[model samples]
Target chain A: MILVAALPQQDILRLLSAQSHPAIYAQASNFSVADSEAILSISHESSFWKRELHFQQLTQAARNAGSYEIGWDGYDAPKPSDDSINQGIALLNKIKEAGLSPSSVLPSADGGIGISFRGQNGRRALLEISNDGSASYAIYGKGHPRLVGEFSPTAANLAVVFNRLSENL
Target chain B: MKPTVQHLSKAPIVEAIIAFALEKPLTDSDAVFEQFYALIQSDYPSRNPVKMAQLTVSDQGSSGETQIVGARFASADGKRVCLVDQSNFICSRLAPYETWESLKSEFERLWKIYSPLCNSRIARVGVRYINKIFLPEGEDMSLTVRTRPEIAEGLPQSMFNFLVRLGVKIPDPQGVLMITEAQLPTERPGFVTAVLDHDLQFRINPESTDVWSLLDKARELKNDYFFASLSEDVIKEYL
Candidate 1:
């Protein structure tokens, strides 16, 4: 015999509030269930959607990953250093200041951080920030040739990347 | 072909604004303010100081606001003025439209005075032109007739009012030029005002030293977008 039980509404609300992913909160807003069990079940899959991550959450994740151990493929990876994590946080703040959001934030193999953006119009771009404070970016679209370049972490250089990303946004 | 206007009795320009962003926020805005006051006080002796609150609203429906202190320096006629904020600079010219060259020259003049007080580089420069085109009364004054036919063909006949916005990339892909057009009803029964606003903007290297050249490029892009978006007849009638 199988048994079924429902969780309390208060617990569901708590679980939803604790979610750092923006899309999870957005999805939970429409959750019609009056039970906690259902909410908990769906919360497990919140991070599955890459686009659910918000800019603020990305910054927090980058900061928390200062000593991240997991690699991109679950293998050994270079953990982010304190300086690299700080630079990553600053880069995320600059991205928000430029009115942009990243699609994903991942720790790079070289103890750096990678911010990726997937445009609605099939354009894809990435910005890699090294621990030494150097930045490089690449942009590619369907009909255009790939654009790749390296730049310093100055406001001007960031503006160039921001401007291009804004077009896709 | 060079675009020229044969003097419309009533110019269509509603407002003209030129703004620039600094590479960094001024550490001591008060000192810069005093220097700006000393420079503009000669011509714009009358002043009406102003304060602004910058607000940022999160996607999750949260609000954050911060106070931004600034002042407005105006000419005796109140037609010309410069607004200086912590990191942003703006010069505006209202009705009785001055020619583009005159407005540009005035803004450049003010920029010269204000730039010296700041120890930051130029990050971005922008120029905006807002125009209100009034349609003639008792005629087939449809937007289709006033604007380029290509732009109007996409709309349905049942649509009474609409707003269309587009961002076009410049030749160098270094900037974005935005064009916004709206059809609004006027107090007069048969008259409607077509609001056309254009903004040309570009970001530059922080080490850039030639601010005027960027402004000039912005002006040229603004003109290009203005002419390309409207039909020649519309420009001749009201520009």
Candidate 2:
């Protein structure tokens, strides 16, 4: 997980308030770890989009000059002033050059673009890149066996959501 | 051999060529074309059966011509049957089969089979727009019904596999499984209960059937969810 002070507290707080990740919590609540594990067992069973998105992130980071930081929702404070939308666009542009087209980005109404990437070990990372370069990072994820309360975006305090996501890697 | 007594008189097929000149009117040309083709290729008795190759579209926006060619013959019990082939493509709409003797014979044969479907034992069989039918002239007539299931060839794999797996044992061993969209459980209560009652089961994900595992995690968990028959209320509730 890439954690950094690039993002401001206001931006993260705004996303949380707006319910930027509306469907994630309920889905997580209903999801079973056993299914995720089973999916991870067969490489071919995973989505091409998931694999492609991860490949672009890893490969682009190699080409670009930026430090990757891991932020946990429980541990970190909201960015001083949230500006994830522009940051997300920049990340997306960088990855597009590397050949990636995200099906959809979250915080769509706001400037923030939530970039989701499937991680190793069946974990996932939601990259809430601020619209500006000033604050852009990733949120690693973790959850309980059933994934019930573990990775719910709604349940997490702003910092916990960000920090917990950073722990995905 | 006694000359077969002709009991039926020649029903001169009253024909009319309603051409749409200036006015844009919705005519039964397409319907007439379809019925005529069915009468010739499938339901009508003919000395020779012909299959449609392609339909030629005229410069006019709505005008086209159908091409018919292939033919085959079969013999049984001192009687001969000629079979014509037809495809269920949209292009088959252009051709009109107009040979009266063959058309009448095929119509008579088809009516015999079609009449039975309306009976109590048959329940309800819909009148599908079939592009082809095989009608043999003279004696020994048979009308066959064709229905394609979801798993039939040419169907999308996502749809095919999902539908085919319903009410059947999954190739892999598993617990009771209900494979369908969660909406309107009351609408399809019988289907849902049958699946729940089944010994082996796997559900096709509602979001995307291709991603078979997407909902697998959500579905297999134990929950006291209600299993009611499908109804309008269930439809409204889900929507």
Candidate 3:
């Protein structure tokens, strides 16, 4: 319940003038662009484009990881499902956005993805994105402590875990 | 003091949309549609399903299918439209561009009605403005077009027709300003028209219910890019 701004009411004069003026208060229009051959046929490229490329890379990696054969690991591990890959990307985006670099984003034998984080004091953390897009995380080192719980990326409730991983054990 | 944008005699907007994504999609499609139709029936009476054709190849021969991707709820006048799907709820106005104030007011009014029904937070908010610069026959496009050459990513060879798209970063709010420009064909020969579309958007905390500021900022940015895309001589035509 915060006040973003105090927006002024539309002036009475402008409202009256809008009825008769050809130049009304409307913003610019571009509806026909979608149908234009020039807009739909082609697009320009930029060598320095990286902002969108980051997410595209994540999605692509997840897709590639999901393509592994079931017996590729020499065990009876199943391939990660589409849902798990999507959830894995969600977790990857969170940690990437948190400014922490992960050691690797690997697919787990349990048909999910694990994001391994290496922190200071040689501490380690692992976030497992399950097949249903839910998460389970573990922090290893110093008796392993009490670092076992489900993580919800939607809630962004990973602050404590993220801090612990970035700091000392 | 509040700054005002000069009303152009010819506003170039083809479609302006304010889009919102729900935190979690409403799973009950039929119920959601019935409830939403009930809410918007007064303002947007006509309902039409938006479908996308899909071609599927399986063990059997390829089969073409149509998927109900989304739906559009339009007003009786056909000027205003509301587009809704599982996760997105968008309010749009087509041509005969009106003021931003009217659009904002309508969005707020509809959002209030649709919010409780969503049972989810607004995950993302975005505003898109599409402006097409129209030039009648014999009018020179060089006057309006900028000097900076935009390269099309498609075919390396010289192009007979192309569209330029650029995603500019907004450092302040951490969003992408997707600007799309393309020259369009005209019904009448030699008449030139180009479209400049600006869409400003960013992800936000679902809990952050205060969205008017973002919407207002998008409008401001839209206006800024719209005017900047044109040269002084061409802008004079709009003024």
Q: Per-prediction fnat values?
A: 0.00, 0.00, 0.00
TM-scores for every candidate against the unseen true structure: 0.49, 0.16, 0.53
Write down the worst ten-residue block by lDDT for model 3 chain A: A40-49
The number of clashing residue pairs in model 1 is: 1
Query: Which 10-residue span in candidate 1 chain B carries the lowest summed lDDT?
Result: B142-151
lDDT of 3 by residue, B39-92 (tens): 889988878786667888998889998988666787865668887777777887
Backbone clashes for every candidate come to 1, 60, 13
Q: Per-residue lDDT for B84 in model 1? A: 73
Residues A31-141 of candidate 1: C-alpha lDDT, one tens digit per residue: 344322222222222111111136546765676677577574577677776776777766776775565657778778866888888764578888887867787888887
Which digits, one per residue and each the tens of the lDDT, describe model 3 over residues A1-169?
Answer: 1111111211222322222222311222432332232211111111011122344454456667778878668898778887887777766666655655566677888767777766544577888877766778887766546467776756656787677665633
- Which residue segments of model 3 deviate by more than 4 Å? A1-169, B1-5, B58-60, B135-142, B147-160, B187-190
Model 2, backbone clash pairs (residues 3+ apart or across chains), number: 60
What does the lDDT come to for candidate 3? Answer: 0.63
**What DockQ does each listed candidate score?**
0.01, 0.01, 0.01
Could you say which candidate leads in lDDT? 3
Predictions in order: lDDT:
0.61, 0.28, 0.63
